[model samples]
Target: MRRELKPLQLADCAPLGTEVTDTDPRMIYHGEMIPVMTPDVAQGIKDARRTLRTNRFRPTGKRMSMIIDGCAGKTTLLLQIGRAYQGLLETERRPDSVWTPVVHINVPPRRESNMDWSLPFADFFGMDHTINIEKRNYRSTDMTEPVVHHMKESGTSLILIDGVDRIHDSELTTAFDYFDCLQDRLRLSIIYCGRGATDIVSEGLHHRRRGERLRTSQQFRSSLPVMEIKPIPFREGAVEEWRSVLKAYDENLVLYHHEPGSLLDFETLLHERTGGYMDTLDQLICQTAQQAIEDGTETITEEGLNDMVVGRQDAEDDWA
Candidate 1:
């Protein structure tokens, strides 16, 4: 298949603004968890997979994946889904344990060392590193063999890999493809976490690095499960839960945070501020509260938020 196709992105479903006239330190605070909101797309993925299996067809277990770009609560949602999946599998009659529980892995961080994933995997599991890090033998391929084997036996059927774009393209692709093959061997389900549209999953099924150690030069790769998790839509349900929490700290959060009453202006403003990402919204509100505390203000108002941002920006510029 030589046809070229574009992957669906959040931008496609919902238009969002990109330009930022200025940045604020408190903006980072908007990236916390808002547990009340539902992960609708993720739930749909799980539901669809379950339905297929219940129908008695040969169901290739679907991997639940979310792309956590800088703004989206990808990792948070992944954890949420994992928790829900755990509850479902814990039932006495269910065979979820036979499938892999959630296995969380990362690609590697940027501006760091050579990003050997085996290190984190080993350290996370309290397993010995293939060799002493100080030793020269650590970089060789032989060391990763044991780490790979342990992962296979680790009973991780549902793999959730974050930091996907952090590693070298070729190396990351190799490691991802290897796990995908394990799915064929052991019926493992694959879930990926990454940035932008790197096309990792499609390429994964095409390359059979383990069986033939071979490459599928075929043009179009198969699609693994993918959902570009955008932020939550601005509404009463979304804001009400978080706003209630924020009200205990700074009352200013409730300024626009009324009973969502189907108001487009409020909805648009909230969504604009939050971009629908629950974590980002939480951070913003939390920062507002922290600023209120620092300013020695008891009740926060709309004026307070503006004053806080202006004061912080000025302070940051002075320090710079």
Candidate 2:
């Protein structure tokens, strides 16, 4: 009864109350959400924003390109940047003088291939790709052309497109055309994210010779100043420091009563399992909390953390 508060109570008790339940995994997991910040992740955002300000943050300028490799926390950082930009645009509202951020798009790919070269922006902006069977006089061009007109009228700064790896090679070539066009057309910042396309980039556009493709695109790699997000720095006795993180959530959630070995097992388990991705670490902590609840225990146990690693049924997508 005490844990289940009224709907209004949740709002009224803001900053004052927290719901505690024996079975709710959120009790510990929500409170103890950890952020793994490295120089790469932290500095990239600073540098990206600096680049945006310097590049005039408009699509008319040279399209800013950032190629982040796998597991470098690219997606997470991009979303953070989007939110930060949203806040800035919301504040700097000079309807005619300034442009504002509007939408964020994450497109993987469609089932059928070979979309029109221009459909990258239009298809995402709600143009019907399916052909008209009943002589419906439906034209995709008409649908897309208005969006360009709308952008010219409205104050839209950018349309962020994330996860470009899913686009097929043919589709990607078509996308390049759209990017080239959008740069000339509107104030749209098209940000694309993918892991395995650096080679394609090296081969297609800029390489001087056939074998020199990889070496030539070293310019792209070397050009960006090597921003890599790394794991949280841990000292020799870092397990003790990790325990303090748990204690911050709830004193009862700690292991070994504030001793050195308090969180050694968890630290080792997570470091081995996920290499310290913040999302994986948060999931691990939540899974442990659920185990503790089911076991009717107060302290997070070594077995509980291990169970989280082992019980990842969706091994490919989950922490694995």
Candidate 3:
């Protein structure tokens, strides 16, 4: 139930110097490593970009979301999409004008009113959302006017909100109302990223603001498209994707002795080691690479991978 990105050739890195110098090229290359464009990240960005592009001028723009369970790289995927979209907007933006086309914020842990929801956006632009009515007393200001003003002024068209899953059922009413108000006024495209996004959005359909009718789940789905990122399954046909992900990382690595596509040799082993979870796989690869660099091995070995344990620690009883 996912779209595949067009295959891309991995960028080639210069070979590290054999001369023993004071600076280690291994460490240097490690710091310069870029985020791997895994299948989820690539496809998510593609779909999100298309949605954002199509919704650019709509009076009521469409919504999109990326949901990933656990630490399967939802934040990474969201940030990449935001950066890619922002890069697209930058080319058309006036060189002298200071405008933010993308706004990224995290859903707050605590939510009481619409003001609470607005706080994160205000904090992002460093706007003050509090008013001092008296010498010692202050009250939260309704930042709708200022927030909308700055958004419109800055030409902000897309908002990337992380952690939508944290919103309590009680807070959904105000939270959605605030979002609805923004859509009605600004027609901005929004991307929600979180573990519980699907359930949250489905549940949100049941909670409607006073005097407002709520849309069916089907209608919401038509408007707000959803994408999910889960652990890659190492089964028939699906195993190839797992290897492709590893291949992407391996090609980007700068290890001197690591043969291109050598990682594919351990495809099944790597999946078994990390259970095909992106975060664990990433940690395993990165930590293993760093260890190899420190140990002067300069290459990843199956034995080295066998020794690493990352991600949610299992219970002592389950330990191998």
Candidate 4:
């Protein structure tokens, strides 16, 4: 027998916040993923997964980069991949043994030194004790080797380095040199996530010292293949598709869709406002959902979206 429909509660919907929850398996397995996948992003995932699988035994000593604009969902995709890979590793784990297939670390913001870059790895792999010992006995530049050794021991085949763009312009050469050393020593497949290629390549060109120029130039055109993320376009059926996804999540979820001024109208407005960026779209959905719950209407309307815009503007004004 078919059950009676009820308004979907906000608590039932996926949680939304500033933190990147894309890697959370609960959300992903429950079909809360962003419904759009560009060809570039799709191909990049395929290539990266293939490299990881291939190098798991053969040791490719190759690396790849996924370049996307800020808030273009690079971290989301990387986290998703990491979660999936870690799940696979869990199945193969021996009794009382740990296997970590993917190690993800974010490059520290506003710092561009090898020490800063290597510290996250030590922390991620829980090698802080070893790192501290090395710090007391050896120079800061020597800390990375122990981390690399720990990674190898842990059966980590794929390393995802997020926020590579955070590396300062002055430290670009050092950053690339460190990456090169990791590739040479570890023989593992790596994926570097950054905002855009221009910033990454330009940093090398603009700031490299005279002696480092030739070497840095050679590394600038990375041997690793590059994947560039393109913005998801606002299309004719975008709203309908998004609505269908929402329905999949909760059939009783009410949304505004009048004939002349339909949901597509609001979608079109949003697309124009956000330039089809996924992050902004996510924010809109979250804001609308929260507003719907608070109003006890269980319905999303153009007015609600307008309110979100005004609210955001007011917040910014307050800050200003």
Maximum-lDDT candidate: 3
Per-residue lDDT for 125-195 in model 3, tens only? Answer: 88876777666557777677788989999887778888887887677877877876786677677777787
Best of the candidates, TM-score: 3
Q: How accurate is candidate 4 locally (lDDT)?
A: 0.57
Q: Is 1 or 4 the stronger prediction by lDDT?
A: 4
TM-score of each: 0.56, 0.64, 0.79, 0.66
The C-alpha stretches of model 1 lying farther than 4 A from their native spots are 1-34, 38-71, 93-100, 109-117, 130-154, 207-222, 231-269, 293-300, 307-320
- Expressed as tens digits, the lDDT of each residue in 241-307 for candidate 1 is 4343333323222222223322222344444555555555555555554454344452344554444
lDDT, candidate 4, 154-245, per-residue tens: 77766777887776657788776776677667776667777764457444435554233344434554335566655556577555544433
Would you give me the overall lDDT of model 3? 0.70
In angstroms, give how far residue 207 of model 3 lies from its true place. Answer: 1.3
What TM-score does candidate 1 get on C-alpha atoms?
0.56
**Clashes per candidate (backbone, < 3 Å):** 10, 0, 0, 0
lDDT of 2: 0.50
Compare candidates 2 and 4 on lDDT and give the better one: 4
lDDT of each: 0.45, 0.50, 0.70, 0.57
| Tens digit of per-residue lDDT, candidate 2, span 109-152 | 45232244445545555545545747876544433455566566
TM-score of structure candidate 2: 0.64
